[model samples]
Target: MREQYMRTGDGFLIVYSVTDKASFEHVDRFHQLILRVKDRESFPMILVANKVDLMHLRKITREQGKEMATKHNNHRTSGSSPSPVLWGAITPYHHMLSKCHYLIYHLTKRLCELLSTTCYFRAHKIPYIETSAKDPPLNVDKAFHDLVRVIRQQIPEKSQKKKKKTKWRGDRATGTHKLQCVIL
Candidate 1:
């Protein structure tokens, strides 16, 4: 799967059940394999620990899942500053600011919170959906849709040069030709 993803530059959504220790171990091994492959680093992955209804039989605890996420987040830091959400607070605010500025500040804070949460989830390669195949509250189709949304959100857009199209270059045929030759 990793090889196929690497070769095609396609993302993957891997869902696994963690009912037993062996299955959990398989997840760990696959996670390590993903890290080792290195080529799929940019590919999106949604690691779902499904079948939470069978928690009585679960070998992997929620805390273990969180720890795995933390490990991945730490590994991918790249010496950059910690996420704003992780930092917990921004600089001190001005007392003279108007209500509109206060509202903007709060809005910005909320936006940062959302971004950081999403970043942490993607960085850790952990996307969990608690669902049961039997007596399902959220159906399989919805779960898959959610996975796609998460994966799409996780994929960071690459910086590309913007080409100016004047009347000469606006010809459909010429634009198509240029697009065909432009390599990513």
Candidate 2:
């Protein structure tokens, strides 16, 4: 699955439920597989801890999730210069509202760490939003829009830099000719 995604060159948003220890472990393994892919730079990753509505059943605490994200971000950032803030964790609205402020706090702390360590996201200050697939007030659309906005901002900057570097040497001659023509 990781290879397939890498071949397509599409950024990935990975969603996993944290209801039990088994699922949490599964997420860890998946994360490792993603990291093993050679062209991981082409693949931006967002880790979503879904079903936060079932906080009572949460086998993995917010701190654990943040720790995993931090480790993953650190590894990815260390390998690449100006590492993009491609690492983040999101929670559902139910958890956000049910007196689980710890979730937000931990996520914020992790974001701060990533910003401090990674140049790409630090400059942009990537957004963190809460969402719920189940509730209207939570507004999954807004969360996704925020993600899209960040991606749009980064991808274009990368492409623009590449475009500038690839400009034809003849462009200067053309510009000179146009100026002479105008003067004549």
Candidate 3:
């Protein structure tokens, strides 16, 4: 049943909890399953580490997640496979840009956010986003949005013409029956 969805899904989000070491270890099995089901060398996948709010309980490091993503990331896209999304630190305020240059201040701040996210992905690879679903979530929406972009990047431009939408109706409550692709 799970294989059925994997066969139909265009993209995947492989989510693992940062606090669960065992869950992180199980990622490879799921990844291999997706490949075997798709029978493809590469696919659009985003490796997500959730539960970031509980930093004290985190068992997986960000570096570890990134290394895993690089191993699983596919670079079929034309450009740097995985560029970036909005994230990272804010730039230091310039002494010259006082209260007088309020417009520059806002633009610079926005630019800084965009630039920070790209630094990690410049090498071109799968996105590894750490998220927390608790109140005041972080990167949850970004993860899904990035997955869409990744899928779009993989498809050939010629076939990108909009196709008729087909609605899928599922009878079971199982995750597989409703959507395509595994989220574990």
Candidate 4:
């Protein structure tokens, strides 16, 4: 059933939880499935790493998520294929006043986030952003806006395949393309 939707889809938003390794893993699998179903090596896709607010419980590194995207995209960043959708690879941190929430104090976490962005910009070349509901640098809305823009741009170009022209029983090729009104 999902395959059916994929077949007709103009673009895809593949999301995973930043805190869950399993969700990140599933993003990889889904990427493969989409390629198989659509039979295209590349398409307009956005990979979102959500739930960054749960920093303490993060099981997947930012690098891992970006690496997975680079792998699935076959390392080709541009040309002919539709532009990649803007992605949100978020990193959330806690404030002293927000003691009611859990927090992760690993020094490398922020470094990893910065490294992932740098890698993507320097090598992978995909539009990447970071979004967190409970943190700064939030971009959840921007991710969706980018998705809509990409889909609109790609869908029209992809559907440019020449459509077959059909004629009705009383139709004439030389006549106006618009249907003629008939009165009894």
Candidate No. with top TM-score: 3
lDDT per model vs. reference: 0.38, 0.38, 0.49, 0.45
- The 10 consecutive residues of candidate 4 with the worst lDDT sum are 77-86
- Between the candidate structures 2 and 3, which one is better when assessed by lDDT? 3
Evaluation by TM-score, superior candidate among 1 and 3: 3
Candidate 2 has which clashing residue pairs, if any? none
lDDT of 2: 0.38
- The sequence of per-residue lDDT tens digits that candidate 2 reaches over residues 1-184 is 4365444433333333444333333333344455566334333444444445556865545655444445444211101111111222223333323423333233221222211212332322223222334443342344444445545656977787787333333457557432222244
Error of 4 at 59 (Å): 2.9
Q: Could you tell me how far off, in angstroms, the CA of residue 172 lies in candidate 2 after the best superposition? A: 13
* lDDT of candidate 1 over 85-120, digit per residue (tens): 010111111221122123222322222111232344
Q: Evaluate model 3: give its lDDT.
A: 0.49
Ranking according to lDDT, highest score first: 3, 4, 1, 2
Clash totals for all candidate models = 0, 0, 1, 0
lDDT of 4 at 22: 40
Badly placed stretches (over 4 Å) of model 4 are: 63-129, 133-137, 153-184
Report how far off residue 60 is in candidate 4 (Å).
3.0
Candidate closer to the true structure by lDDT (higher is better), 3 or 4:
3
**lDDT tens readout by residue for model 3, 1-184:** 5576577677765555555554444445555677788787667776555566776876656666555455646321111111111111111122211321232123221211111222333343556777654666566566656677777777875366665465665866674544444469
